[model samples]
Target: MSQFIQLHLLTSYPPANLNRDDMGRPKTAKMGGVDRLRISSQSLKRAWRTSEMFKSAIDGHLGTRTKKLGIEIYKKFTEGKVAEKEAIEWAKSIAGVFGKLKGKDSGNADAAEEKETKKKKGKESDKNPLLTLEIEQLAHISPGEWDAVMDLVDKCISEKRAPKLEELELMRKPEKAVDIALFGRMLTKNSRDVSIVEFGEDAACQVSHAISVHPVVIEDDYFTAVDDLNKHEEDAGAAHIGERGFAAALFYTYICINKDLLIENLGDNKKLAAQTISALTETAIKVSPTGMQNSHASRAYASYVLAEKGEQQPRSLSVAFLKPIESRKYDDDSIAAIKKHQENMDKVYGSCADFRYSLNAITGEGTMKELLEFVTK
Candidate 1:
């Protein structure tokens, strides 16, 4: 068995009351003869994206001070990297695709209008028509869109473009560190209590990244930064603000503080890992359900990674999530979406097809709360 931290998070509204039958449909059961929370991982991740921390984190990764994505694109195009025709077409297409401006389709124009009216009667789309517009601009960059970016830049330079709510949205940064890239590596490894042979058991100073041989979990947030449903028409999104948000998966690097001593005793790794896990047991009480901010946890991680690291001196370990593309496709879906969401993800793997690392294929729902106590031998 491996000694590590296990975190359990779920959406507050999802009620955690989950039960599945033989066919995996909603069923009911009693543990203490009572119903418990049934939640989905997707839902849980959504909640975390909406937290304040995630928003701040997104701001941290991408600058939030400017609203020049359109402006930036425009500049790039004007500089002649992209043709003017293409840039405008991109802007028009993206606006059409993501915008809710569709009042009617030719086949059922009247019917469509009626349906739209009914929908608008309730909750309605954002009050501002521009909300969807901004979101669309942020979604894609084409030749025309690039010109729009230039236009935006021009506007901002002339103090024309104003920051909107959409500009505030941010995305999570998954590949800020090589070590976190490795954490996904260790998580996929099937061996339990398997001390990495690459890094010395007691090598503390060199430990750039680490992962719990067990589970590292986070609390669920109700608001998500990258949710498909949260897309807006006029939000202008991070693009309007010259900032961006992570609407994708994230990777983190961890370290064992008591590595040297644990290695010397061998048996001590469990205790140290357990204790350290305990300290991090407190899950995020507040996170955005919509904004999965990618804050560089390196600074904060330093404390957690080097926690209780000593004058007593001890060896440490570092691990990174295998570059997303480098890790084996635990399944087909992961491979498809993992890299598409983050373009840089593909670049990191380069031509190295050595992605043999495993992935923790969590099947059932419910937080593995008890795994927190799973001790290492």
Candidate 2:
């Protein structure tokens, strides 16, 4: 079996804000001394992991990333007819096993602001006082850990008491959570006993921020919304006007998976590991970031895909685009450059990969099934 699997992809999107900057414009990076649109690794991973396709493929093998575990626990206990005060305390005790509780002194600015906003609106924010039970950070809870937590919740409600210290040991090796095994997660030490907490897992896969292979010029789309009720000539003017930033580009994405580490992360579950790789690879090739999709509808599949497997150290083919591809023959040139670079790299580095397969949509060279098999097999 190969130790490493590297994927190179070229996908094109038209006039869309696939990923956005803080200012609501398309995200960009200065690469090779040129401005190129970028889709952040974080954004890409979130899209792939949360996509319906990935979720359906690995339905039972996913984890939930949330800070509302305490809130959920409190609600569950309350629904079981537990007293409000007791429920909050019990929920805190259980949630604290995963991460620090968001207390009055926790200095969580966002929570504070939300509470203050509710107060200003003359709403009784304390109506759901359990909101304060939320944790300080998002916890990635595997299905196993979640089941354990729920079991403890049921016990506490039935026994009419808080969870025992031993029962609070909710951390479990993620045998079923493929998302956790692929991306990994960090769990803070238990507030009660640091030694009792399971720390974290190292990510078995690394994703690069997808960047365009050519220079980009972001453009603004200015338009107006019309009011159908207004029929008079004086009311012919648009009801609302706005402008949004957009750009079109062909992006290059790279992913490297440490198959050995992935299997180990899943507790040596080779079958699950293969499924994870297949699901992830398919998601990467098919899923598009949801940002501004309603307005631009910019969904795309990779036009060119290169999948390589080996025990050798992985390297990205991004260096091929250091000199931007000309717009005249952008897609063809970009693909050619990548192929040439891989060939050159093999010559200089003595075969960077042991086996390789490619799917070129432009040339109709290979099937998706064949490519998936080549990588997962």
Candidate 3:
């Protein structure tokens, strides 16, 4: 089996905000001593994992990242014909196991005893409404673990009591979801209460932040929206007007996949591992993160991809742009630069991978079908 799969992709987006920074501008990073438009690895990973292509390729194997476990539990119990009040209590007990619960406990006699003790001193107040228990952070709970949690919640409600902390700890165990295996999870809040011994799974795939091959010059698109309801009065200029930052660049993307870790993450299922690699590569090639898609409509597929498979150590070819590849309208400067980097790597590392395949859109040639076969085989 191949130990590693490395992908080098060159994609171009024209005048769109594919990813944004805190200031709502296209994310940029300084690379090769020049400012280059950047799409974060986090953004890229999310777009691929949640893409329709990925969903279809690996159905029912994806995990959900959310903080609404309490709401889900509440809905499930109520749907099971449990009363709303009792359901909320049951949900709170289960949620508290994941994180600290705010407000007074609404469940058992221990809480009622405290309430009565406070009332004896005339200190109880009706101003506080019941607050639902919530996890401090969004948890990446797998489908199997969700089923387990639901079952435990059902058991708690059936017993007519709150869940014990030790029982809630069961939710933390890894359930071998594909996305969890690839992206991993990190739970810092209430880690002591869960069965998770580590902070998060070490990601088997490493994605570099996508950066423009050439220096980027930010452009501002100024525009206005007319009020459709307003009569076209001479004085009725516009309903809204805004300025947005946009850029066009040929981006360089690099990804290194550790096949061994990937298989382990998928519970030693070789078939699932192949499916994961296929889904990841396809999504990475096709999906652009939807940052301001409606506004800018920036969507594009990779112009070129070089897929390599081997048991050799993995390395990125991003050093090709260390001098900043010069791009032109009618020229293939970016592609040429990457090719030069690959040649240099071959000369230096003496064949970086066991096999290599190339796909180029400009030439309208190269085999994605064969590359996928190589990676999977």
Candidate 4:
């Protein structure tokens, strides 16, 4: 098996906002001394991980990433007909393991003297505490950890005792979920004694933020929505008018997978590791981030994909586009130039990679089966 697998993809998105910035405009980054439309690695990862293809391939192995974990725990306990108060307490306990929680029932004391006095007397304060409990940060929990927490809650309730802190701490070491293994998590402010291995394992995959191969000019599509209630012909003006940012460009995306790390993350399950890579690749090709998709529907697939398998140090072919692919008269497309540049650079750099496979849409060459076989084996 190869030590590393690298995928190089070129996909063209039409006018759409697959990723947005703080201003609600399409994201852009400066590359090659010019502005290029960008799709953040975060956006791409989430889209692929949550896509139907990924879910179908790795169902029950995905993690839930959210701060509303109290709700999940509460629901399970409540379904078992556990006392509402008891369930809330146990749920909060489990939630606390992931992060600090705040709520009316939470034992936290505020700075106010009156609240402190109320807490001292074991009395409720005049100000109502928040009904909902929330974690300080979003927690990524695997299904296995969730099950463990549920079982622990049941055991404690049956024993008619409050959960022990030591018991709750066990949840910190969850079975790694596929998405967590690939992207990893960092609990910088964790208050628990969980080891690095128990919390955020090192990410086995590195994804470069997808950037346009050429410079891009952001354009606005001014649109309006007409209200159906305005039936009269004299009601000519639209009900709402807004402008949205959009762009069209061929994007270059690169991703590298560390085989050994991935296997370790999956608890030494080599078969699951291969399935994960297959699912990830398929999702990347089939899924486009659904940002303003209802309006623009910018669905696209990779036009060209060059996959490499090697034991040598991994490298990206992005330098081929460092100068930005230019539009040429004889060869209008940048694919040829990008491919040529990669070949030339590899030759100059000792062709560090051991094996390579390619799939191009234009010539209808290269097989996905062969690519998958090479990467997995």
Question: Best-fitting candidate, measured by lDDT?
Answer: 2
The count of backbone overlaps in candidate 2 is 0
Overall local distance difference test of candidate 4: 0.78
User: TM-score of the candidate numbered 4?
Assistant: 0.86
Instruction: Give lDDT tens digits, candidate 3, residues 120-206.
Output: 433322343233445546777778777878888778667766666667666654446788888776664433334323436767899
- List of clashing residue pairs for candidate 2: none
How do the residues 1-377 of candidate 4 rate in per-residue lDDT, one tens digit apiece?
Answer: 54898998888888889999999998999988989899999999989998888999998899888888877777777777788787777777677676655433334344476466546534322242223446656778888877887788778767767778778767654357999899887643333334212366689999999998888899988989989889767877899999988898888899999988898888988888999998888788778988989988899988888888888888887877778766742123667766777789778888868888888876888877776777777
Model 1 regions lying over 4 Å from their true place: 1-34, 38-43, 52-94, 102-377
Which residue pairs in candidate 4 have backbone atoms (N, alpha carbon, C) closer than 3 angstroms, thus clashing?
Answer: none
Global fold similarity of model 1 (TM-score)? 0.23
The lowest-lDDT stretch of 10 consecutive residues in candidate 2 is: 117-126
Q: How do the residues 232-263 of candidate 2 rate in per-residue lDDT, one tens digit apiece? A: 76767889999889999999999999999999
Report model 3's TM-score to 2 decimal places: 0.84
Question: Cα RMSD (Å) per model?
Answer: 22.3, 4.2, 6.0, 4.7
Which has the higher lDDT value, candidate number 3 or candidate number 4?
A: 3
Off by over 4 Å in 3: 75-93, 96-132, 164-175, 189-199, 232-234, 327-331
Candidate 1 on 1-377: residue-level lDDT in tens? 21222121111121111222354333222223333222233332334333344434433221121122433344444464445554433333223322222221223446767676646643332463222223311221223323443454344335433323232121122122111111111111112212211111122112221121222222332332453554577563443222321111222222232333333322333443334233222223233222122332211111111122123222222112222223433223332333342335336644222111112223332222333233121
